[model samples]
Target: MPADFHRIASGRPAAGSTSFEAQVLPYLDAAYNLARWLARDDADAQDVVQEAMLRAFRYFDSFRGGDARVWLLAIVRNTFYSLRMKVPPDGMQETFDDDAHAVVDEQPTPEARMLIALDVGALQKALENLPHPLRETIVLRELEECSYKEIASITGQKIGTVMSRLARARERLRAELTRHSTEVRRHDVQ
Candidate 1:
């Protein structure tokens, strides 16, 4: 948890409502995970989480007492998009794909599955290489283990869109990792 988390928890909600500590603190790491992957930097991730925490505090009263994790995450997602508008773009540059609608969900090769299971570094690099939408979807669904409905809530997209993104993300990751695994094997044969 950030140092700000302790101070932020001081904001007491009304009687019968959950405290900030009880609500958002538990998911701080989750928020950081989402932000870190999205921002693609430790420093920027911290900044994004901090701003998100603050926004959650400001609107803490508005929380209707259901799924604080999802609610806080929605705020974090919004905060990231908001920051993108204010600041210049950073190193993570994935062009928008116009043909995402046409991407067929494909099964991974066995080698791709093995790579994903065994090669954490390669998997991480391939995941980072994905487009932001795909990356975020994978991170949210795989890393955070959010339900499609929760993902839709946090991302403000329909469940179908979330499913589509997750499928696309997985397929792209499979291709990248499979290609990498093949290259590594070729090198070993020499």
Candidate 2:
């Protein structure tokens, strides 16, 4: 290895220090958003992010020559899966009924509605309705803005698999939004 590599590598402040904060803080909200989307609970999401950060700190040295976002997200993904595996089989299953959902109306801005129109909480519930792999792919690609290669690395799947899952996730989300809109219309009709 080139001698300059050591200085470049050691350029970052000590692990878990202010440097870690500088690097990790900006991504915190996004990471938590993703973790919450994946884990489906405030507490569990917090736990996942905390664990991910710790793991990232511990493994910071191994993160040579790669996108930090992907590295951090891979840790987050692993943390989510670890927690997911602990849930009981029955507790892990989710069922979504097309007939029961409502469509989302994107027309009204918050200023127009005088209230937050899009129920992010409801949308989050809908996202949680998806299968784990699909949910992970969606959160990483769409929410976290990870590229195909990054997503592939984080999920330990091939790029093609990431692309496929993202496609499926988009389709599922569209269907879900449509169902939600339909349900809203049904309620309006009644």
Candidate 3:
């Protein structure tokens, strides 16, 4: 048997009892994905996820019967922020260029449209450029398919704040994609 199987078997709670793996492990992918987007570094994301999991395990007893995914994600977000605060502030400076938000022309040729099909690298870079709050909102709503309520709960924000952040994130993402598409078309013409 696989090690995981043995662990599950040995750690199985009695009927009607909460099983840690059953509730928490199932959400590991979501947790890791969120961490990756927030941390923007594979190793750092892994560290965040591991720390979050340990913290979740340590606090498992306090978890009431509710959405385990939300509970776990809340822990992940908190862990990521805690780790973020510990890093030296000097290395974290990011200059926000106002011109990056300028609206670009939207004229799309057939060829340009064809070339615009899901450019993962460009999209990732655009997302990386977003502020962490906006990026996290987009990831939770679009990537994780979380509801606004869930996002608000996980992020510890008001529902209105979550809505505004998501709206701004989408608008920024649209602007980024448009800018990227224009650049790609110009490159093709060269």
Candidates' RMSD to native: 8.7, 7.8, 7.3
Q: lDDT of each structure?
A: 0.81, 0.71, 0.80
Error of 1 at 151 (Å): 0.2
Minimum summed lDDT over a 10-residue window in model 3 is located at: 95-104
Q: Which residues of candidate 1, in runs, are more than 4 Å off?
A: 1-18, 91-118
TM-score of each: 0.79, 0.72, 0.77
lDDT of 1 by residue, 1-190 (tens): 4455555556553431247767777999999999988987777788999899888977877889899999988899899989988887854344323233122335878757554544766777788799888998899999999999999999999999999999999999999989988888887744
Q: Estimate the lDDT of model 1.
A: 0.81
lDDT of 3: 0.80
- Best-to-worst TM-score order: 1, 3, 2
**How many clashing pairs in candidate 1?**
0
2 or 3, which is superior by lDDT?
A: 3
Cα lDDT over the full model 2? 0.71
